[model samples]
Target: MGISLQKGQKISLEKEAGGGLTRIVMGLGWDAAKGKSGGMLGGLFGGGGGESIDLDASCLLFDEPGNLVDTVWFRQLRSQDRSIEHTGDNRTGEGEGDDEQIKVDLAAVPANVKSLVFTVNNFTGQDFSKVENAYCRIINGSNNSEIARYDLSCQGSHSAMIMAKVYRHGGEWKMHAIGEVGQGRTAEQLLPQIKPHL
Candidate 1:
């Protein structure tokens, strides 16, 4: 088990790992909201309208001045410098855990890169009202131990969320849970909402 985080909470990776940490995995998971059943007739005739939600997980690398230096998302699986890599896109939030994952090699990251912001977007245009159990977690890549988790409990008409950020603080890396809901179908569209947090 790991420390569960609320919105705006922050945790230190080195402190949580109990020593130096080199690599970490940021995992995002969610499920489509189950549709209402229309009684026995609906079940027999397949009237339940539960549809799969396509949520995209993205990592944006920023410099000290908050400029976007690189990105890793569905469109681009790896950052330009090769320090951050996204596992790939999962169209349906169907499986048990980690619908999408982005791995970061902290040591390989550039010195100027101060923050890695993680965001989730409803690429299919469905609002979060149609999604459930969305969460972002950080795992120690070495031992697969969960360090921290932030449950995204915001359910509304928004299409995107600036979930959390891993940033350099006093020569160590720390994670802050943002959990801010907004309107964006892609990482590029969410840039404006991310600056305030950076």
Candidate 2:
């Protein structure tokens, strides 16, 4: 069983798995909230089946001093160094499990890249009030086992969230659930907001 992380909780990846984790996957999932119109009527009037939200998952690499290093998202699927890659963009939060995934080769990351911040945003500018069952999970890429997951079930009006972060700690990597909700449709806009949390 995987561990469920609360906001602000931190866990060491190496300590939890009892070995060095070379690769990891950050998975983001969500379900669109039901529209204002009820069941049958909603389906008939383009309120249900016709509606979709585009929530984008991104990873921002930062140096030890919190300097922006690089980013990986829909617009840029892979980092310049190829250490991080976004699987694809999910136009709608359909299906079960992970709607989007960002794979990272921890062992291949540059030495200067000391921290990785994960974020989710409604690229369409839709508020989180219309999103539900939102969650982020860290999976061990080798065996596909989930090491930890953070459920962002707190519905609100914010359009973006600094979901979690992984940083170098004592030569090992650790994860922290930031879970800080704010207003931003892209990672660039959230830069200032992510500073204090680092």
Candidate 3:
């Protein structure tokens, strides 16, 4: 589970509280690509498949401004569902380079969403590695204004996991980035860290 989206659970990023708040953001990053088999671990203790986890994948935003596309690269993954899935692999330098961003159309959002869940996946099975300062922020929307920003970065690992963020600001429902790193994959392991003492 590790901060994941369950069935019948939809996070709403649309601000209908008369605040004119609109827009959703998602970003990803990774370690620097130089040594260690040119970014990704070359020889491992497993199978030999899948594309290289190195290099950068261009960002794709929906209903965005002109000539303002392709925010950055972060070795994004090709998984189930593009817009909703946030499992990207960035095997590059740590700290900072260029944050990868993706935007969604606020007006085009579904009406069944109550909150938005922002998930990140960058487990490369290589200890002694670190991933720092990776997250997403809302930029703009229908009212020509910006909303709140979320922090989606955390410690690094070598397995598949997710961190979900649900937010409620000023009587408005906003999924402010709530990503986290855990031991295993399960809602039980993550729910505590996310909504502890609840």
- Candidate 3 local lDDT, 67-180, one digit each (tens): 212122243332123333233444553446334545544444433333333344333433322333444444443443434444433334533233444344455555533344
Give candidate 3 regions above 4 Å deviation.
1-18, 33-99, 141-153, 156-171, 183-198
What lDDT does the true structure give each of the candidates? 0.90, 0.90, 0.38
Q: Please provide TM-scores, in order, for all candidate models, with all chains considered together.
A: 0.93, 0.93, 0.44
Tens digit of lDDT per residue, candidate 2, span 62-170? 9989999999999999999999999999999999989999999999999999999999999987778678899999999888998999999888879999999999989
Per-residue CA lDDT of model 1 for 1-198, tens digit only, reads 789999999989889988779999999999887773377634542456666679999999999999999989999999999999999999988989899999999999999999999999999887787788999999999899999999995788899999999999999999999998989889899998899898
TM-score-superior candidate, 1 or 3: 1
List the lowest-lDDT window of 10 residues for candidate 1.
Answer: 36-45
The number of residue pairs in model 1 that clash at the backbone is 0
Give the C-alpha miss distance for residue 196 in model 1, angstroms. Answer: 1.2
Residue 176 miss distance in model 3 (angstroms):
3.8
Order of models, best lDDT first: 1, 2, 3
